[model samples]
Target: MTVTIRDASLADLSVIASIYADAVLTGTASYEIVAPDETEMKKRFQSVTSQGYPYIAAVDESGDVLGYAYASAFRTRPAYRWLVEDSIYLAPAARGKGIGRLLLAELVARCEALGFRQMVAVIGGASPASIAVHQACGFRMVGTLTGTGFKLGQWLDTVFMQIALGDGNASEPDPESYPGTLFAG
Candidate 1:
């Protein structure tokens, strides 16, 4: 099945919400116990897009959303303006087909183009699939937070992985003029 990656639109919010809902309800990728409704998801979509961050969807030729990904402020502080946290979710049928890798690559390229210097992945449950995929994309294991989350009748770990974007702190950060600051403002 051919998949196309594109900027997510308001019309895609329902499918995006559905994909995330499945992950929240059944997978360890998301720590949220309750699935967020479409309204809440729409708000989140707007929050990211309005800030000039990329929120993307992977869809089949038929226009079905197979997965989605986005970059958001790693932290709200101004000093963290050049850093972004990435989140990805895929439908059950889309797993293990390299779609995650495709979506993540596009996210990295978009973030780099936006002048973000670092990208982080906070993988819930230290999922092997997620870790492997991140590793394949050049993210190194930063650390894992043990027992940081309680879900599905067990304590879960959150794995942290990171990758450097364009120029990644090799030079001093000029937050005042960086494109990444658009989100900080």
Candidate 2:
């Protein structure tokens, strides 16, 4: 399939919500017990895009959204402005197709271009597939939180992986620049 990656639009929220709902219901990638409705997904999309964070979708030749990814503030504190967290979800048919890597690579590139110094992937349930994709994109295993989540009638671990963007910590960021108003006083 010829897949294209582009900025996610308001119209895409329905499919995005469906994909996320599937993950929430059937997979450990998300920790939420209930899949949020489309309205909630729309709110999240606006929250991310309004903050100037990159939110992208991967679509097939027919323009169907196969997967989506985005970067969001890792933390609300000013000190964490340089770090951003990544989230990705794919349709059931899209898994193991390298689409995750494509979406993640694009996210990393866009975040770096926006001056973010680091990107972190907090893999829920310590999913091996998620870890493999992150590793393929140059993220290194940082740490793992064992038994941090309970879902599907069992305990799950949360894994942390990180990758440096741009100059990373080698140089300090300009005080005047940041992803949107996340650091605004």
Candidate 3:
């Protein structure tokens, strides 16, 4: 099935929250045990987009949200502003179809365009599929937190992967650029 990646809107929050809830409850893609409702999800959507970061949804030809992805501050400290973390969640039917990779590629492109210099993947549960997907999109394993997550009656590892974005660290960013406040740090 053809999947289209586009900016996520409030109208898509319900479906996006549903996709994330499944991951929260059954999958280890997210460390959040209690799934947030659509309202909370909308707040999160606004927070990310308001920061000039991207929140995107992957939809099928029928306009159904197959999955969603986004980038957010890797850390709140101003020194970490140029680095961002990525999150992706897919409907059960959407997995194994390479949709995650496509969504991630788009997210990376968007973040790069926004002047983000680094993209990080904090893959919960050491999920091989997630790890492979990130690797396929140019992410390299930076580290892993052993037994950092407790879920589904077992200890889980969180894998950290990273990739350089446009001109990544090859040159200094212009402080007066698109992502204005960030480059100054």
Q: Candidate 3 lDDT, tens digit per residue, 29-131?
A: 7888999999899899888888788889999999999999999988887778888999999999999999999999999999899888999999999999999
Estimate the TM-score of every prediction.
Answer: 0.96, 0.98, 0.96
TM-score of 3: 0.96
Clashing pairs in 3: none
The CA lDDT at 71 in model 2 is 96
Q: Pick the candidate with the highest lDDT.
A: 2
**Cα lDDT, all candidates:** 0.91, 0.95, 0.90
Model 2 TM-score? Answer: 0.98
The C-alpha RMSD in Å for every predicted model, in order, reads 1.3, 0.7, 1.6
Q: Tell me the RMSD of model 3 versus the true structure.
A: 1.6
State model 2's lDDT. 0.95
> Quick one: best TM-score, which candidate?
2
Cα lDDT over the full model 3: 0.90
What is the clash tally of candidate 2?
Answer: 0
lDDT pick, better of 1 and 2: 2
